[model samples]
Target: MDHDESPVLDALAEYHDRGYLDFAPPGHKQGLGADDAVRRVLGPEVFHSDVLATGALDDRRSSNRVLERAQELMADAVGAQQAFFSTCGSSLSVKSAMMAVAAPGETMLVGRDAHKSVIAGLTLTGIQPVWVRPRWDRELHLAHPPSPEAYDEAFAEHPEAVGALVTSPSPYGTCSDLKSIARVCHDHGKPLIVDEAWGAHLPFHDDLPTWAMDADADVCVVSVHKMGAGFEQGSVFHLQGDLIDPVRLKQSADLLSTTSPNVLLYAAMDGWRRQMVRDGRELLGSALRLAHAVRASIDELPGLRVIEKQLVAKEASHDLDRLQIMIDTLDAGISGYQAADWLREERAVNVGLSDHRRILAQLTFADTPERTDRLVSALGDLTRTSLPAPSSVVLPEPRDLELEQVMLPREAFFAAQETVPVEEAADRIAAEQVTPYPPGIPVILPGERISAGVIDYLRSGKTATMVIPDAADPSLKSIRVVADT
Candidate 1:
């Protein structure tokens, strides 16, 4: 395993050097047919690199094994037993991992705070999910990853379960104790799958929270697009341990993955792996220090409190990612929605995910002193001109908002579903997902028995500009429900 070898990139370079052109699917003939308008904005290099994984990057038969070598290099770089690439992004990678562990109708213990993609997996695979509760910070109004004790309880009762899945470094960067959870699952001869989607850089650095494989997880999925230097839609899943077969995991990914994977993403992933292997710790080391300084500066702002290790003391989470600078704007007399809107419109500084209480400023190694200074100065200006008070958002009490599933997600979703006015949709079983965008976790999963309190929260949240993308109506005036015969 020569760590410096970038097989995908090497092949792509050779392909271009040979001048072997084909008038194939990309009518552009490598930018010849590409429109000037599109080229002016996106540039011709983008088109040049928009190659098919097989025919464009390598020969039709893939004699070079370019992708295979790249995957191995990635695995070695991260210290995982095996690494598999997915151009479909971690959304699909996670679904493939779930399918490999257990078939349809089997039970899997899942953190209730999981991203909507996990909910989508349930719909696709028909896996019964036993929910594990996250510790909710009543005062901060934040949610962290579920505790190990919670998963232990679920496994204790559902001994017949095949495996467990947990989310680490949640959108807000709170992490779970994967080591403890792994021990709990392994004691029962079950596997632990960590959806470390926001933590591609975890393996590249030492000071960050524990990387899944280091904590003995059987399967871990990472989205390189989030924290690594790769094109969007680039994802990889690392598999280890006897509980899951590498062949079966690869088969599952192949089943859902696209045949025409992007060559550019592959090359980027390959390069990132090399960069990390050679110099990740150094890069990430600087990033962690810069993030700390940024957090301290932000905390000095009036009406702002940066969430850090303090939130881990809350119920569910065991750790946190300090790079995710989460600030509670509740004291500012404004909702997170307002602050986000103001920042984007006024200062041209766009934050990441925002909810009722906070706006997250997601930092990466890409940030420099100039950009960070801009962010701090912008926040200071915004606070100085702040308005009188933010309208209080009424959140549903936890018990009232938690809905019950009446049917399998797949059944209620694809079955006879029709739209009903939101006013009348309460208490009616839901047939579609109601999710909050940015973080993209579903608030109301399919087949769930709906409640009035949940509806009120969603309705109000919608009015206040909390994004709910999958609703039948973006306005949420009506909800799709299981139709009657």
Candidate 2:
């Protein structure tokens, strides 16, 4: 395999060189029909490369195998048996991976701290999830990926489970011991699916946490856009071993994928693979060094603490990606929401993943000294500014946060539902997802019996600027619940 070869990118270049005319569905036809204002804002190159993946980028029959070769190159780059591109992002890829191992009505062991997308897969497919509890740090108010023992216990209890899924490098960059978890799954003769959406760069650098494929995971889905240099919504599924059928995985993805895929997204991922193969180590090594410096500098700031030792402690996460600089703002006397809002509105600096007490600065290989300097300066300014104290959110104990599932997610989501006031919603089964964005983990999932502690948490968190975007009522004044039979 020639690591330098970029099939999708080369085909795109050839398409431009051949001067192919399109009477395609895009209707823009290389920006000719696009509005001048739109073209001016987005640039002509964006529309020019927006060609159809089938008839335009490759032949109608796809005899050239441009996309196929690109996928092969990506798999080789990451040391996986096979790779499938997804223009729909890792959310769709993860769902496809889930469906590959477990069919509707079958059981799968899933970490409770999974992203809302995983829960969405449960609702769309009738998969019964045996929830695995993540290692909760009650004092830090954080949830690490569930340990291998947890999965082993789950499989022992529910031997009927077809497979398992775990999320690594959680939004805050805490990682699970994937090798152990994968071994646990294989010991039970079940495949392991890793939602490694935040770990696209893990393969390119050794100092970083272990890549899912390297850890012997049967199936791994990564969002190239998150930690790699690719267009947004660009994702890939890496599959290895005979535990999961490659044909079935592809078919599962095809079921949820769009017929008219974006050639631009394909080309970007192809180019990124080539770039990473050639220069990823150098780029990521530099990034790791910069991240260390930035972490030290941020930690030096008054009233700010960089969370590293605690995250990778014996009882917490097995590993940590230092690139994600999670700063505890509790000592700063303002909430993460306030710091995030102030930083964006005042300094034009946007940190990713803000929570009740912490703000995360996600540093990727693309970051430079200048960019990080600006972040540090803005954060320093934030500490010095006199801001009104944020209202205290009624944080729930770890046990209270774990609501009991009363019915299947699909059943509760589609069943006759009624909206009730928040005060009256306790003890009722939830008919919808109420999630705080940034991390996007659903605090209240459908079919889960809502608790007063959860209600108080949501209500108070909402008052303190938490954004619950998925709730039927974002205001939190009312909640959607399953109606009485």
Candidate 3:
């Protein structure tokens, strides 16, 4: 398989070159019938590239095997036994990996600091989750990836567990000791899955933290859109070793995937794989240098601290992806939310993730010196500007933050439920996930016993500009809890 040959992209080019008119499901009919305003904003090319994966991109029978060939090229480029593309993003891909490793009623080891998507996977699969505690920074009020010993403890407590799943380069860019964790899992004859959505560029650069494949993970899910040049929602899950059945992984994905796949996303992913194989090292090398310079510059700015050293200690994370420039904004006399809003509204610059006291500006190979300079100037102006900090969130202790699980997430979530005031919601089993978006980690997952402290934290954070998009009641005035039988 030639890594240079982007089959999906080539086929898409041919589809346009041959001028094949489609009477297919996309009622827009190649942007001709699309709304004038939509066409003007989205451009006609997006719709033109929006063709059926099998019928248009390949043939009616998919005789060309364009997608398969593209996937093969991706696998070869990444040094994986197999690679599967997902148009639905790594949210679906990670869930598919989880389901393939552990079935309903079985147990899987999962880090407590997992993204909301991983919690959703637990809810969707009915797999019992043996929670491994993440390394909590008490002073910083942040959680890093759990250590290999945490997984070892979890497996010891639940020897029946089928496998383990960990999130590397957490939205904050802190990485777990994947190699040691993979060794721990493999020693138990179980597979290891890495939810590495923030690490699509990791494999391309050796200086970056070890990606899942090189660390010997059985399966790893990546979102190309996050760190690569692919369009949003483009994701790929790579497989290696014989621990996980490739057929089972495909079946799991098919169960949750769409029947009508997006060819545009497929083509972008195919093109990106070729790009990475050819020039990823040089491109990422440039990004790493830019990130270091930016971090140093940001550190020099009064009242803004770039967090790098504290993020990679033996007690914290095993490694760090420097591209994710996490800044402590509390020193700037304004909350991260205020800083983020100001940057967007005033300077037209948008930071990636923000919290009560921190803001992140994600750097990628696509970012240039001009872009980073704009970010620096905006942030420098932000430090000089007079903006009052928002009210603080009363963060709970690490132990209090760990809610006890009484029922399986699926059962408690789908059971009889009722909406109750925040005060009365305490001690009740939660029927929904309440996450702080951007970093998107669920503070309270379904089936967990909701605590008054956590509730107060959510309500206070919301009042202080925290956004919880998945909650039934984002305001925290009320919460949905499993009804008593």
Candidate 4:
């Protein structure tokens, strides 16, 4: 139970110290076989660490159980009964979580503002989703995580639902009232699966919103790469309580997860867990202070407003992660997309998530005062310079945005489908999800009737350079819809 022990890292170190030869699938042979150019640019250490999880990270005999110890350490680090690491990121972890709870043809309550990955899970499982409506901010054209009252209503309507899944601390950092929502699910004798992908650091900090595990969620999936020190694609799903079977969770993950996992990712997660356990309080405290200063400074800049107060309004989110410094770019006479692009292209800085009216700057334990100063300076420059506003996306009225679902996502997506011009696509059943990336919430989900308002929003949003990566036609000149019978 010693948190100091990083079994994966220790084993990798021993492998190097013992000079073990690997005739493994990587074919890199511990960087010796790597191309000189590749090694020169990437460094020899990357290839050296590119080891096979089974034969290289652990012995072929499977006696060491290095990953097992690492997982145990991780579970212990976070307050979870069990934890499983995933190299495939939370996308696969969430899909596995969904499958573990509900099967094909079963019903589950899901947040309508869920990420594209969640929709993909519904498509793969064919689980009938009873969409739980999020608290929409009409003034901002944004969606917050659904309130507990919404879940209570959905469960009342569909008591047959096996479970519920909610996304907490949405990419913009608006959090759901998980404690109340989890209580609502438990009242219905169903488990709650929280997509807390943006809240990995919540557990380590007291000022942050409540972590799902602490809030009684049965299964909570977190992306360590997002808020923790782990490498990209590193994720961990935690489970506490008897509501969800631990064995089944592992089985589901095994079905969806890769056979050859990355040792580097495992090592990074192991190391990050140690770092957080040892000094996360001090580190995150420093980050919180810096964020406070940054937020005040950004607010002082003319024509720029940092969004903190509105996020926690009574009708808005239950909590907010202030680490996500969301700024309204509208007053600066540009769209969030334009500000984000200008920041990256002109100032060599990149913000986290950008939408029609706002740009986000994510502060982390890794951020320093110098870096924050640079961000403030670049944003100030943006405020002073006048820029033409980006093309506007047609904002749909709340009523018009609610398209009726005609079929299960799987059926409509795989059904006979054809592309039709944007104008002609109205009233046709959508055969694919059209989402604006960054936040990655789908405005048009498969199986829903595509309304003219939704179509116009997408087409105009695309014209303004919104990146709709999931659409069958990214250009949005035409859309894929279920063909007429």
Candidate 5:
């Protein structure tokens, strides 16, 4: 495998060199029909590369195997047996992986800390989720990936479960011990699906947390756009071992994928694969160094502390990706939401994930000293500013946050539903998902009996910086619940 040759990029070049014309569905016809204003804003090259994947990118028959070759290169680069590209982002890729391993009505052991997308997959596919509890950091009010023992216990209890899925390098960058988790799954004769959406760069760097493939995960989904240089929505899922059939995985993806795939997204991911193979170590190494320096500097700032030791402690996450510099703003007498708002409004800087007490700044190979210096300065300014008092979020105890699932998610989601006032919604089965954005983990999932503690948390948090984009009523005044029988 010549890593130097990028099939998609080369094919795209050939497509231009051959001067192929399109009268296809895009209707833009290579920007000729595109409005001048749209062209000026998006650039003509965006439209130029927006060619049809089957007909224009690889000919009508796809005899060139352009996409196929690119996928091969990606799998080889990541040390996986097979790889599939997705223009729909890791959300879709993860759903495909889940469906491939477990069918409707089958059980899959899933970490409760999974992103809202995974919950959506459960609802859409009707896959029964045996929720594995994550190792909760009680002091930090955060959840790390579930421990390997948790999965083992889950499988022991539900030996009928088809497979397991866990999110490593969580949005906050705390990682699970994937090698041990994968072993637990295999010991039960079940495959492991790692939603390693934040770990695309792990393979290129040794100091980082272990890559899912290296840990012998049967299937792993990664978003190249997150940790690698690629267009948004660019994602790749890799498969290894005979536990999951490659044909079934592809078919599962096809069931949910778009008929009109984006060639630009394909080209970007193809090129990123080549770039990472050639120069990823050097680039990611530099990024690691920059992140360390930034972390130390931020920790030195008054009233601010970068979380590290606590995250990888014995009872917490097995590993931590330091590039995710999580700053605890509690000592600064300001909430994470307040600091995030100040940085964006006053300093024109945007931090990644923000919660009641912490703000995360995600660093990648793309960051430089100058860029980091700006972040440090903005953060320094944030500490000195006298901001408005943050609204109090009525956070619940870890035990109270775990709502009991009363019905299947699909059943409750599609059942006759009623909108009820938040004050009276407790004890009722939820008919919708109410999640905090950024981390995007659902506090209230469909089919789960809502609790007063969780309701208070969401209502109070909403008054602060919490943005619940998926809630039917973002205002939190009312909630959608399964109708009384």
Candidate 6:
């Protein structure tokens, strides 16, 4: 219960003090065996901190209670009844959360705009998805988290659903009305799991989008690496109330989580929690002000519309994360993709989460006036000497993109399947997911009856240089489908 005690850091410090040398799993034993080239690039400190969580940080039996105590402090920091750290990031944490409440073949209400990882969860577990459609802002051609009414309709149809999951503060900075959605879920005795991966900094700042824990989400997964000061892949999921059993959640995480957990990640998580508790509010306050200024400045540029309060318009999202600077490049005669490529290649400014319509700049407490000024200057320069715009990327409309569920995802994924060229695989039931990265929503989730329109869009997307890492081709040229047996 002591907020000041960081068990993970304490144990790590103890291990170092005791001169705990290991001949264990990590071939790079305390940087002694690390290649000089590797140490030069990654630094010896990284290898030194990569000690075994149990064998090195604590003892074999873990009598020190290092992880357990660290989790408790994290829970306290976020006002959650329980918290579990995951080195594998929120992607794994969210899957574990889904399986904890719902089992194979059980129905779970899910937002259709979820990350590709959620679709992966569906394919892995046999959970039947009851899709809750996101509030699509057709004008912006962007997807926001589903409104409460959308989830209400979904629950009305599948009242027997075990739980609901919503991705609030969607990658584009749009947020759902989680408080109302939570009330809706609680009224039906269903737990609400918020994929709040980009919301780790929310709790500390009042002006930011409401944190899931504060909004009454029963289970909230957050990536400490996002909007927080931590190493990449640092993630934690917090839970409160009787809707979800914390013990079951921990057990579920343990089943999917890695056995050789990273002590460096745990220490970073500990350090981040302490930093946030001590100075997050002040740091975030400055970042918010800088974001507002930057957004206003970006708006003055030709053909650049900074999607800010424009997102909060009742016609769009219910709420918005102000720090998310979404710049629409369509008016500039360039696709968001083109603008992103040009900016990065020309000015060395990389925007986060680019889509056909917009490039999103994810501002964090780490952002400063200097960095934002650089971004604004780059954009200003980009539009001035622009090359010919990219050919129009034919994006599928909200309806055209939606696929018909022909079979269960698990069956289609695991059942007899054949590989065919993507061009010829249209109209066949998709046996694998073909999703565009960046927003990472699958265009072709397994078991869905693929449409020609969707295929054309994805194929065209690939031609335009869309990153589809999960696909067999990454170019969406080949497709996997249930074979005619």
lDDT of 3 by residue, 308-426 (tens): 99999769999999999999987777888999999999999999999999999999999999999999999999988988658888898777789999989999888999999988988
- Candidate 5 similarity to native, TM-score: 0.99
What would you estimate as the lDDT of candidate 1? 0.88
Candidate 5 residue-wise lDDT, 367-456, digit = tens: 999999999999989888998778888988888799999888999999999999999999999999999998899999999999989988
**Please, what are the lDDT tens digits per residue for candidate 4 over residues 76-101?**
88899999999999999999999999
Clashes of each: 2, 0, 0, 0, 0, 0
lDDT: which candidate is best?
2
lDDT of each: 0.88, 0.94, 0.92, 0.91, 0.93, 0.87
Model 4 bad stretches (over 4 Å): none
Q: For candidate 2, lDDT tens digit of each residue in 60-134?
A: 999999999999999999999999999999999999999899999999999998999999999999999999998
Give candidate 1 misplaced runs (Cα > 4 Å).
314-316
Give per-residue lDDT, candidate 3, residue 21: 84
- lDDT (Cα, 0-100) at 265 in candidate 6: 88
Clashes of 6: 0
Clashes of 3: 0
Question: Once superposed on the true structure, which residue ranges of model 5 sit more than 4 Å away at CA?
Answer: none
Each model's TM-score? Answer: 0.97, 0.99, 0.99, 0.99, 0.99, 0.97
